[model samples]
Target: MVIPKMAQMVRCRIGYFTLKCSNRVVPRVFLPLKYQRLCFHTSWLLNVRGKEVLMPSLSPTMEAGTIVKWLKKEGEKIEPGDAIADIQTDKAVITMEYDDEGILAKIIIQEGAKDIKVGQLIALTVEPDEDWKSVELPSSTSIPSAASVSVSSESTESATPPPGQQNLAMPALSPTMTSGTIVKWLKKEGDEIEPGDAIADIQTDKAVMTFEIDDEGVLAKIISSEGSQVEVGQLIAIIVEKGMDWKNIVLPTTTAPVKSSAPAPSVSKPAATAAPAGLKPPSSGQVYGLAVKRLLEEYGLSSGQIKGTGRVNRLLKSDVLSYIQTNNVQKVKLEAVSPKTTKADAASRISAAAGKPSSYEDIPVSNIRAVIAKRLGESKSTIPHSYSTIDVKLDKLIDIRKKLKVENIKVSVNDFITKAVAHALLECPDINTLYQNGQIIRIPRVDISIAVATPTGLITPIVFDTVSKSLPEISETIKELAYKAKEGKLKPQEFQGGTFTISNLGMFGIKEFSAIINPPQTAILAVGSGREELDSSISPITRMTVTLSYDRRAISEDMAADFLAVLRAMLEEPTFLAVKRARNFMNQVE
Candidate 1:
């Protein structure tokens, strides 16, 4: 390892360094001399310290990203694992966590800074409260202006430049979306925008949809031209200090458009398949762009009549077509609303009818709604699902929860029910199998996912080794995953790989409802609100009802009913579940 004495001229470039294992050495002639000729070694060593924060390898395809905002401001103290910035990657705006504790001393690449290659330094961070001058900064390639990072100590510091002045890149809206076409600008440069304000219309391979601001900011600059095909993470616009210089902001040419040969139908003509009865149809004028409109036309469906169900009502042409095939119903002609209005006219009319178009009204799909749509869509199309619901008097389970609550256990009614189901799974092992890879994959362990509803979406985190975990452990896991899911921080693995799922909305006072089975899992249990009412004896009391939606493919009606019967019995006798714990809970009891 060699250290450069000259700090100002030292060029720090990734890949220049090679790591040689001192434990073993090969002959000089046999070794690659060129690889050994460069800088320091080690695969994970970050060479440059006080400089820009380069793009991380989030996925295989991502090469670079524009800094959307620095979550931590210059001079602000940050600990390792603290998110320092939010980067607009090709996929989404992901939080960039720093691994070292420091104060953000300088910003080599300012917020909205664009077109940075991977491993390029974007900021300078030094040990907290350390002298900035003592820090070693490699000063090769492009040196950012020192003035760019200076901030008045009294000024309210922000991670990014003032809203409207910070540049944001287009996001990869979907797993398959490689690029986006800017359909139109909803807000012009200099327009004031609040969180949720429509900034622009972007057309992805799937749909034409509007993107909104996550935080309140102003529209400062338009980077790529309207209609340009922008790759995910490519700067599309800039919002920063009102008069910040953008001359040094370098953006790579938008990547080549991802082309597809699929033919889109004409906007004027609806596609052959139509929306279901009572659903409104999308008109040619309402079609935002060519790709989405063509796909909609081919399917002959209306956007309004069909629920978008995406994060935003960003419907791709595929969604419309998929809705048509799944519902298997023809479109119903919508009643004309007076003289029809053109798309542009409707925008103006809505703007006039409502107060500010900037404050436009749109109902975004909560994370729950999006997940529900995806799961239900898959279940309906892919899984042959038939539901079986049995009403179990929850008097015993409620009493058990009450006793547990008094003991400071605080187990929810859902918790008690989940334990009962786990016990049942142990007895009826076949009911716990999942259909995958065109065969029934019997999971050896019982992993149950509890559906928790948060404002953002419905997420089900797993109760690991459900058969083995105690009631309290399962309840604790449920609470933790539920919180993470509501916060949108749940990793894919957390919600994945379940043999069965339980969806309970009893707390919300919902009663006796059927839930769509979450795919790959053979069954889902929808637990509804318990009610206090008179029973067959005409005595008033509180009780709950439950429903089970099962995959008819792997489980027969008789087997499903038997599983519920076991669950009902276990719930009725709390000791039945206690005995389940005695069995080591490693495998299903049955």
Candidate 2:
């Protein structure tokens, strides 16, 4: 889409006078003659031969990536297709590789840098004996088109800058930073600002940090409030009055409406705010203080005409009814109202019966919470679910976990249990099948979903290709994916396409409970706390009680029992599962 470069006119209705709009732009020089040559400097370098790197797309759908790390030190010669750095896209961590021949002489951009837009210059490398740093760099203005400039003067006849250059917005520190609250302005309307001078203390989602000026020019106007939610990419301020030595900064003409010296009387729109005749207008208090006020406004009724029978002379529906009854405007029966209106009236009556005023709480639902709600609601309503519980000895699994911890695996006992269930899913595919369209869809791939508790609610992000992956790989992937899920940043693919799910409450110290199956998929494995107990021989024993919830339509009782039995055995003897994983990996590579 071609965005328009329209000039903005700032006008306000002062008292009783209506101001006329005018076409004007801020007067400021765009670029110096020295900076103008930056375009020609880089024009020749574009055709220069360089190494082309085809990095692995982190997300299955990512087309490009931003280099997060450069593991290979620059100026170090490397072989073909060597893993240099880690590139992170919208979804996952991918390996960055390049054709190995030239020495990495210069790193144009460093780590933790974004804006690696497709085909953008990320780094510079030199051919053997070639000087890469000798290449001329382009000025920031050389890369952009022209833009309109806003000139604020006491008189209206100030020269306006030519239109077309769009302003590049300020960079945000993080995604959650909605608005940066500007603390203080360091420069005035006509002072030059360098590339790295503290312009303002921008309070972000985390801590307040100093926002630096990009180029040297006079500081124009601050556009944002000290404390307000600013959009991700927005011009917070402007720089004007350029000099020969410094490049000019063109300001965008279209800025948000500021609190002008004049305040326009906001007359409510006729379509939305027109009230009935002979009724006194709404109070000049708040626009919407109560539900009665809004309801009256919605139905075109005024506040004063309706006799308030509610507490503290507040208006209510009964008062509106009484007022209509007292005046013989029109006679109507309740049943004459449409069904939709009747239902609304019924809901209102029920609400009134319950309490005096409407009370509600605002809850912020994360991406994880939204997914959990959608999945569980679908599961409870659609799946024909049945549950079965079995006690398994945790002695072997616990021992395996301890041994792995010593080997630097750093996985919890719960993670091991999840792996065991994944193994069982591969052995008994019938238990992993889903009932859909009058047939059992037995999935060949095992993508085990583990329930994670986020700030909002429970969510399950799946471990991709779990059956084919080893224990350590599964554990690491699960840890990374779970952390992402908890942070409410897991992509759609991570939360979807799961064959079976596991919800472990072991850390919560709960003994055992049946978990509801997540829908379409037939089964869910619920894990509880493992504890020490004396067996039939009065010996100390560590055991765990596991509950499997399966769709009766999809899985038979015998099948569920057999599936749990296999799962129990795997957990009881983790060595078998480890050996099986090794074999599977070897087979895949072969």
lDDT of each: 0.61, 0.58
User: Per-residue lDDT of 1-590 in model 2, one digit per residue for the tens?
Assistant: 11135232211112122222255443323344453333222122232233433335444334445455686776676667877787666444456777666666556554534434445555555565544444334333121110111111111112343332224244444322333445556665556677777777554433345666545666655555565434334455655545432234444443442222221224322333334433447563322223345345434457655555433444444454455434432322234333346565666677789985534445754333454566678878888788899999978666666655555666677767777887888889997776666778787878888888766577678887787777778788888887886665665446645789998998999999989887667899899999999999999989999999999898889999999999888887777655533443332221
Best by lDDT: 1
- Residue pairs with backbone atoms closer than 3 Å in model 2 (clashes): 25-149, 26-149, 26-150, 26-151, 146-164, 146-165, 147-164, 147-165, 179-230
Off by over 4 Å in 2: 1-371, 436-439, 580-590
How high is the lDDT of residue 465 in model 1?
Answer: 83
TM-score of structure candidate 2: 0.43
Runs of candidate 1 with Cα error greater than 4 angstroms are 1-250, 255-360, 364-371, 533-542, 576-590
lDDT of prediction 2: 0.58
TM-scores of the models, in the order given:
0.45, 0.43
